[model samples]
Target: MKLVLKDYIESLKEEGELDSLLTDLLWSVGIKIFTRPNKGTRQYGVDIAAYGKNFQNSIEDQNKEVFLITVKKGNFDRNNWDSGKNSIRQSLNDIIDVYIPNRLGKQYNNCKINIVVASNGELSEGVIDNWVSYTKEQGTKNDKLNFVFWGIRDLVQLTEDNLLSELLFPEDHRLLLRKTLSFLDLPDYDLRHFYELNEKLFQKCLPLKNNRKLIKNLRLLRLISNILLKGCVEMNNIKPAIIASERVLILYWDWFKKRNSFNEKEPIKELISYHFFKIQINRIYFAKVQTSYYSEDGLSFGIGNLLEYSLITYEQIGISATIGMSELYEAMVHFPSDPNYSETCYKNAMQVSQSLGELIFNNPASCYPKYDEHCIEINLAMILFYQTERFDIAIQWLEKLISYLRDNYLLKEFIPLFITDYEKLIQIEVGGYKEEISSSILITCLADWCIMLKEDNLYKNLIELIEQSLPNIDLQHWHPEENTEENLFNSNAMRETGSTRSSIKLPKNPIEYEMEMVEERNIFFDETKFLHNNKGFQHIEYLANRHFRTYVFPNSWRQLLNTRFCFNKP
Candidate 1:
């Protein structure tokens, strides 16, 4: 395991990969970093800056010291030792002649500075004498100025001690991670194992005795996830990696929200790093999905079976919808600081929405979902449609869907149900058994959109149709039971009552109905209502959909209700 991790560390790039890992290691072992890696700016050769004990490794306790670290990826050689502007030698020179004299602030200047040249690979034997002479000469100039070098072995040990310790990822979990990496070609089995690992880690972190340990584990999770994704990239299949990263993302969000650690630097920085990895995977997979958008199945990936066609097409469209929402979320969150940040995001979001619309229009399979579990993707697409205010297409689709399900009692073609058990869902599909449709996340969302859009007639017809055709279907709205948020987030159905829902409420006042649902669950869809740095309501539905492994649902409502894709002001 250590050797595998060491190899991945050596494979990392300097800008966003290696530097970020090193920063996490610094924080993990008690180093206080003030300036992190920021590209597209002049940093005087200092890739990272921090203050702490005289030595970086926690194992070697020493006197206090501050640090200016210049990081490089892979092996270091003679050219790196004395090459031109990009060389470590020149970087060290800049750190001393430029950063120390001008850039180092007064507050951190009092302590003797330790200028460390760090890399994830070994230093060439040819550069040994130069390193020795340089450190000796630097020490002679000023007692406070010390020079140091950290190679691959040093970084591996730092990672092993602080992040990859057995105390965090147990033997079974480690095996599961290895299996996940090996199964990149098979996205379903791959995501299953990955999610299992996440669930176990979440359970372990929840009862932690201290935040320090928790942060270390979270940081480790992100690094391991990135390495798995790197493997996916090498193999030319990152679909599983994208879904797995998204799974861990919401898992971390749930943990952060429950632990109230969003304000802490360590976890938030960890999230940002994980988010960066997610963007990388999405960019790669999005290109592949986009290229096939005008194809026969829109996302067939060459799967020839009809059932397989419908499954993959709807799933792909759902993923595209998620990508769109993510783009918009990024824009809204950063809008406060950078007023111009949203233009590109808005464009990207609409482009993705257009892809979804076109995928549905061109691919007949998209309208025919495989099982009730298909609602997860279908609902996500519906959210994107209403969010972009592409109501005509969405309304037409919803009417067709409601009419199809309302009349068909004999066939199990994507019938809505409350249960999320995958095995039972599959059995229903193959065994010729029909679903009771007692609980429905799909109907709930369709009804909410009808009311929100003031399609009063459609809303009334949906309500009456369910009552008459599928009389057993409750169409109940779900609400989080009192103090059951933890059980909800953890997917612990062992609780006495994790949730409750209402019978369909046909409100005469639509505005009052919207506010009542939003405030009832305290689910605010308006991003502007929350602080820029904090999480908003989208996460609630994300967590629910993920944990339930069925529908993109709100915990309140017959299981889906108030959530609108377009950031409804209510």
Candidate 2:
């Protein structure tokens, strides 16, 4: 049977009758766009490429870059090709070494090798072994090569479902189906025949009540449905077909509920019901209803209906307030904030928030006993309200929430809010604050406020505090010792008792000005030359400026430090 089909295919090809043959085969497989003679040099290294319009083409067509196609016209021998692998191995090697490198450039590393062996005969067990072994050898550890094998069996299977019969040729479809049927396992053949003979019976068995067997059978039916859907799309009536199928699924669900002992009032049923209804709403929104001049009636209807139904069902069941709060928050964040369409969404969100807050505060046994999540939500709402110019309410809410956090030892939770409020307070200049605060919260707030207010004194004080907190060691050396205050400021002491006083005289002018003068003066003299030649007084002015600029109160304390130290280079 395979030999006869192969001869017929070959005869068609020889007589230049392959256009119809190719069309029939492609149509049967649901391929839409067939590029004939795929006109390119070997740079493309692909033959007969077809693009599926339904597939997204955002990325470049990698199938054009690399593709493995097997064209077989003979009977496929899975066992023989597995046993005698050498002949098939050599054939694959010849293609890779000679055809790829010669036709495509030697630098064409991305080329995919395809094998097309059409014979007017059947392949033996040895031939199958050889093919499998060849493929295995060519496959690298990194999977740089891929191989796909096709035979008469595949062509026959393609024709079994009237795929080719609906197309331009019916006899060829019958022949291919008969050839493919010769290789099928008896059980699969039986199932296929049963479905072919009694389609309605198969559909009835698909939704039976046996829990263990029902899932398996449903999966099989789903596979068949997918194939049929693909066929419909190829034929270009997919939308209507899909709608009809969805309606049937809905009717089936209703029928199953009526017939089965399953309780439709169960929680799982409610969950499934919610999901199914939501899916239907989404489909209607995106599909059936057209846009209106003033509003998107489809979206409004879909979301509004879903929301109303969900709330009614949930309220009846006494659902968790947390679930309501979460859903409300999601709606608010996702949907538009427009006053027209979103007014209901916003009102519902607020209601959910309030109810959730009350539940958390009043019911100790509720999941959220401390109500930390609710507190965060309230803070976010307050922040949003503040942005919207509802300052009085925002401030009230913030104060209450901050006080709650402080009372509960959740000061960490309010740190960010504290910083923001502190900045606002400083901008308004309501209070006079003195002395350093220990909290990181207060320090950050004060630093940011000082920067914003342009209060140089406060800024300098903050910088000094930061410097003092830093580890007092020179990091340039491999072995560094702690830099004591005595080493840093001993010369500036009012008395010589060496107690390392905290108070040091501030520079007469701003430190930046002194540093600039020192930098300008030092540009004229070379420190290496001075050290090498021992020229003591040549750059005295620059040296004096460097000392004055680098140290605090340079004029008053310069003599004390230099009194016992002298640089006499040899």
Candidate 3:
């Protein structure tokens, strides 16, 4: 496990990756971080500045001292040590000559300052003589100044001591963590094991009362997430990590929601930190896999991988859109002063929604939904377009998709059903599922979305077509159950879903009507619910779908729902 962590650390870059991790490490270790790494800032030589009790035993001055650290990436050789203005020695000199006199202030003047050089890899042996000479020369300037070098071993040891401590990471937890990193890029893309491992990890944190201990656990969780993301980045496939991160965030939110930990400001801030990290992962996916699926080499994967490749890309677009549109206001609420961020979210939403439309138009396979869960994706994309004021694209895409579903359903059982079996769904495209085609969760949702988008013609056509094509199967649209609030978050909660056939309506202004409709079904989506108008708590069908995916029922829509209201963009 130490080796695994060492390698993970070795993969970090100096500017943002290693820089952020170093600050997180410092916070977890009880250090007061006064200054941190900032991009576009002048080079004053101090990447990090903190004041804390001395942890180093070799230093006899045990009183509180300030730490001035300079961090870089990879192994430090002679070039890195004293190459030019950017060299380690030059940075250390700037910290002393410029920063201390100009910026360190009178408060820190009497305190012993430890100037440290750090990196993920060890300093080369040839630089030792130069380093010792430099430290000796710097020491003569001030008796209170001290110099230290932190190499790979020192970093590994410190991380283990602070973040992945023995008590926090017992042998079993260590094994589970190792297994998680190993299984990140597995062919199945099933993260049940990953979910279970995090459940166990979170469960372990609940009983401990010490605040510092909790910080260790949270920091460790972050380390594990980073390691998994790094592996996905290497493979150029980040969807699994994105899905896994959503699940982990859901698990964490569930814990907070259950305990009513709303008062704990720090954890919420940390939640935002993790949320931003998840968004970064999505950005990476967009940058690397842009149009790769719909390009000439789109369907070039081996037979086994092609189906999943096509299917998940569609799912990715839906997840991204839903997040952007829904969470736009919520994020702005957190940072209310930044009005420009709202525009950024709008731009991202438009880009992803447009990409989804392009994929549907260019790639025939993308137009096909391989599983009923794709309904959630479709709904999310539509809502994004609607909320972001891109209704034309939303309406057109929904109409085209419903028409495609009708045409495909008539020709063959091409519309994916509510089946969780991976092989069963893949078999639908490869050859055909000979079994009696049963109910579909997607078609009904599409009909509802069509109504929401004001496409009365398309909505009526879908209703009539489902009756003619698959007469025996009833189409489902999940609604709130009685006593829904209590059971909604329960493990074995039974959800109520009625046939769309029961309720049929047409409205000229579907957005206003849909708002009323959603309020009637689940009050959480109701903008007027917070007025104490006797409509506060209800089982939001979508929220429950994301929260209650268990082993027995792998709730295929979990990924889409988990990310729906959570924007994954900066």
Off by over 4 Å in 1: 56-61, 78-84, 106-112, 125-145, 169-173, 185-187, 190-193, 256-288, 342-344, 392-486, 492-537, 550-570
The residue-by-residue lDDT of candidate 3 on 251-297, one tens digit each, is 66556555555666666666667767766776676656556535753
Off by over 4 Å in 2: 1-65, 68-91, 101-121, 159-570
lDDT of 1 by residue, 161-252 (tens): 77878887778988887877777666456477778888888778877868788778777788788878777777777777777777787677
Instruction: Evaluate model 3: give its lDDT.
Output: 0.65
Instruction: Give the TM-score (vs. native) of candidate 3.
Output: 0.83
Candidate-wise lDDT, in order: 0.70, 0.33, 0.65
Counted clashes in each candidate structure: 8, 17, 0
Better of 1 and 3 by lDDT: 1
Higher-TM-score candidate of 1 and 3: 3
> Residue 273 CA error for candidate 2 (Å)?
56
TM-score of each: 0.76, 0.21, 0.83
What's the best-to-worst order under lDDT?
1, 3, 2
Residue pairs whose backbone atoms clash in candidate 1: 476-558, 477-501, 477-557, 477-558, 478-556, 478-557, 478-558, 478-559
In model 1, how large is the Cα lDDT of residue 307? Answer: 57
